[model samples]
Target: MSKSVDRKMSRGPSTEDIIEDTLPSTTETTVDKIEEISSLEKKLVRKIDLRLIPWLAILYLMLSLDRNNIGNARLGGLEKDLHLEGNDYYTALTIFFAGYVIFHIPSNLVVKRLRPSFWIAFTMVMWGICSLCQAFTHNAAGLIACRFFLGTFETGVGPSIPLVLSFWYQRDELALRVAIYFGSSTCAGAFAGAIAYGVLATMDGAHGIAGWRWIFIVEAIPTIILGLLSLVIMPDLPSSPNKRWLTPEERELAIQRTEMSGNTDKQFFDKKQFVAALTDLKNWLAVGIYVGLNVALGSYAVFLPTIIRDMGFASLDAQLLSIPPYVAACCLVFLISWNSDRTMERGFHIMGVSSLGALGYIFLLASESVGLRYTGAILVACGIYPIIPLTLSWVSNNQLGHTKRAVAIALVSMIAQVFAIVGTQVYRTEDGPRFIRGHAVCLAFISLSGISACVLRILLKRENTRRNQTYGPADVKDLSTLEDIDTLYDNHPQFRYAL
Candidate 1:
């Protein structure tokens, strides 16, 4: 059972005040930590954030552009140029997720095996090359091949990011960092629109190439440059022995933090943990949520420009209009994630947003009025985009060991990428102008996500309660003396899952 760690200089120090002061300040702390986060840990976290997040954010933005710019390109005449019709465009889109799903587990394992810096940077360069190749593709097969390889190479970075960030950040600190990383997608969405508008306006006829080709070339080059920069700039794992960027004390503390929370032993391959990940119910629940998100996201990324243009705007106006929703989405992503971290709450926030997103789809499906339908798009962006980091952080928060966490991350990601494949194929050109079927399917899935969050929260809460009854409430004071901890993991009596 747990007891309070009260430092009362005055007789009047309330129990609530002790709890408040003892809670994490600006530093990283474990679930049952007695002291506030130290200034040293806070400084180390800030240093890691500064050294790691910006370059990661930039590259993530480029990745989003390279992956989702196809919608923008289509508006700039990619379809006509490539002779894509009927199911050809959908096939190209589907191929990306096919490779994305196939490579998730393998890519994550490779990153764990090799140096994080080299592995991530290498994949970034490869994906950049694949993105560049898309600009030159003359037919469906060429585009599909390029897209497939692009997804394959990108698997190294995107799916493993939360898992990677988990190494450097604690459960308390990770949601916001992950949110910041995921926010790049919204920025890229906005940026993609603005860039497409500019390219279509200025570069369509220059060098006798289509504006869509120019879009690919412009986006691909920067990704390549950023990839090269990553070799020098990217931070390796916190547990890695050699960190030239960190001081000796800071590096020691960084490594210590990993071991402090639930015994994250340094094993690249733990078969027992891998098996645990394979059988975990929580991973599958997360997969449902992620699949719901990607279902909406895939359609939104690939079809938003077309949707806007279909709403009676010119192609250029549609491109320009697309930027606002993404900008709005990016802002909300920050606000929601910050609140989620501040309160240390996950499930309810995810539930609220997914429900709101489903309502947005309802508005879209029910309305023939163009203004109302556009409002629906804004609501959907605001609602759906924020759930991404929330869900990923929750998944990361629950897992115990490094290998189990890594495997769990990859497992959920691979399954979600399966639905991501479905996400691209849901939108048919026949249902175009107002793609009712895609909107309906997205609505159903988003609703499923909200319901799943509620159910999973209940399940986890019940399990935690049962643990308290059976094992006793988790006590921080008692936990420091724990031995042979690696074998127990989440089974350890003191380990608590964050709700």
Candidate 2:
């Protein structure tokens, strides 16, 4: 054995030592045990998918609806009803993100302590109440206040999904799962448009409430109900003693898979982990990538209805037309994310899709054709939507320690929300018709996001090369032991980044 291997063995009980001590010992039965464990792992993953992914996706669907329904409401005469003037409408959209940015890191830090199920459910209930309250807003001030508080309540939902998924899935399994969850945003956009179309058309002035008010009231009902249901349905960590849904063997297998994938077992918040995440160059690079992508995301989510309206479609038709692009985006995100996982690549997928978004913007800038502009819209949706889950999973995959991953994810998301504040302001009323300025800004940011992905990929590749030279090639089977010995997360010698 090498001197480093000898030192690792001498320091304390390796993960292998613990596993050997705990597991059944029988030389003739070793292959049988391995086969049994593999079967159990398959069963566990299927259970996790059935129980976890659908509920999370539904929750995120509500979140996306509550967040972006303002755009739909605007088309349904919210601005006229509230007497919104000048930049008041845009300011309301922008202010929500201020609350969103403020609470991300703090909310994520508390997830483990408070437990994800309770914390997520509580926040969902609060956001649902806030969304419902939007129906009663009599003025721009009232609307903005509801939006800000809604942002505050909904802060943890987005970042927490990826964090929770990381606990259950290996790195390779994460992107697709995240895509499945985040794809709900695209679905939300489509669903919101369809619902808004029906509500505005059929429910206008019903019970003396405007169509816009009905939109808020009706959408808020499902959100509030699901929030209540989540308390019972959502699973906590695999290691939680209270997780009655998981069999003892299944729970052990879940924890074992995570550890074997090189994720640390640390569950509590650590200041040192926070500091390491803050200081990491890769984390900042991820922040840059997310900022650019989210700027485009924030703009599209909030303005697609208005942008479609500018294409000479009637208000109702505009809302309905918005659904197709998001549908396209939703379909494309699954395919792209599945391919990303199948190939074990992230940066190129991000860069390529972001470039597709930029091209869509270019088509918009260069053409006056309605069909071409609509196609541009589809491309833009396809480009930015998938990149959200892909980039999020990329950051989660690279970060090892649970606390560090939590902090790093929150920090990256917070910075993206900050940029989203700016993104919201880009589509000003005065710049309407073509909204050339908004398109240009989105194109520029998308390009920047693609560039950031390339840089990050190259940097990680170089680091992986250097680590291999210094410590030899990583042994996939020995990751659990390496994780225990290397306290520094991804900085460990045996940790090879998925570039």
Candidate 3:
């Protein structure tokens, strides 16, 4: 858990308060809030939106499926199969995150430069191949190597997907869409368990390898196939598309819309702009929020199935039962996103959801009733999944320039994932069967998140008021261009930060 630290610099202006005051009052009006949707001419946005979700979802699904199949594998004797002892499995988990942190920033930069279609698909194939290699692990060293490569390949996909969504959708439309994409990861969690159950039921001892190996091998094949297919179907970008896939009219509309919003430019790396982005205290604040949330999330990801198995279900049945929490999460994600979009509010929605998650963890920590614990599981599934996408959309929407947004997104994501290493350690197998320590840890983190969301909202509100007083007019256009505004907010009068 985190304590409040006043990071105010004594010599300089209260940058925190200044940052708070920079949000535009125009953004606070109900009429302005309702306008995130396009005009009637573009009413078919949902139809096209539907097409985009499956590819993004499938991509995330496989990414999660492969990464977490280890939980299911653990049930099928993976530890024994690979002769793991002490903390070898936890070490493998930590190694994946180490590789994950190493590649995340560069991978995001590549996604910003190259086509998402090609680069993301390439990442998919690479991770899928590594996941398949997991099936061949005969020792701790082999598993570690495979997991490292798997993490290196999959590192970017999580951050890249939100970056890609920010490009196409407005701030309002993005939250729900992001939830849909992120929700798929929860679905993958469920699907992986269910699929693993099926795989184990039929092929327990059939292969030269164990049933755990079959889970990895079979799950991996679809990922590889999907990766290759994505190269063909994935949209390149709003600016540079495979001309064959889009009509000239659609391309023009994309460019024109971005220009109308005063943000049409390719993101390029610049040393000065990068430094300004890094310097913003809010950037680091956002990272802190995510790190706490992720530590809780990662604990659930790596240990929930194991926890269930300890609760009297057989190994296979434990795997099968893991499906419901994630399935419920998928539906809750869409519901929460829609509500957030309709209300055009991010902070409250996030606080509310995270609070629910904290409550779930508290329930698990306090009670021993199986039925009550199962309910807590459902609450955990629904509550945590929405925060990620909402938080991501909030960060991306508030950031002004393309280059700054790119780096900021990568930084938050990478910093958050660093906690995955911490999380993997917190929920050790020895803590199973009502992992009291694990539950308490997650509860503490979720409480931190609830507190942070309040801080961010208050900061945003104060900033919006200050911007109103300073700017003189809500419709000022002189500092509106992306290039001009890029460095203007760094103690400069010309730029205004968005809330």
* Model 1 lDDT per residue over 453-493, tens place: 88888887777777778876655432224665566656566
Cα lDDT, model 2, residue 334: 97
**Which candidate, 2 or 3, would have the higher TM-score against the true structure?**
2
The list of candidate 3 runs beyond 4 A from truth reads 1-44, 476-483, 489-499
User: Top model by lDDT, which number?
Assistant: 2
Backbone clash pairs for candidate 3 read 20-462, 20-463, 21-463, 21-467, 22-463, 23-463, 23-464
Taking all chains together, each candidate's TM-score versus the true structure is 0.91, 0.94, 0.88
Kindly indicate the candidate among 1 and 3 with the higher lDDT: 1
Instruction: Report the C-alpha lDDT of model 3 over 10-64, residue by residue, as the tens digit.
Output: 0111212222233355756344333322332164345347657778988898898
The deviation in Å at residue 59 for candidate 1 is 1.3
Ranking by lDDT: 2, 1, 3
Query: Root-mean-square deviation of each candidate, in angstroms?
Result: 5.4, 4.3, 7.4
- What is the number of backbone collisions in each predicted candidate, taken in the order shown? 0, 0, 7
Q: Best candidate per TM-score, number? A: 2
Q: Per-residue lDDT tens digits of candidate 2, residues 405-450?
A: 8898999999889998878988877787788999999999999889
Candidate with better lDDT, 2 vs 3: 2
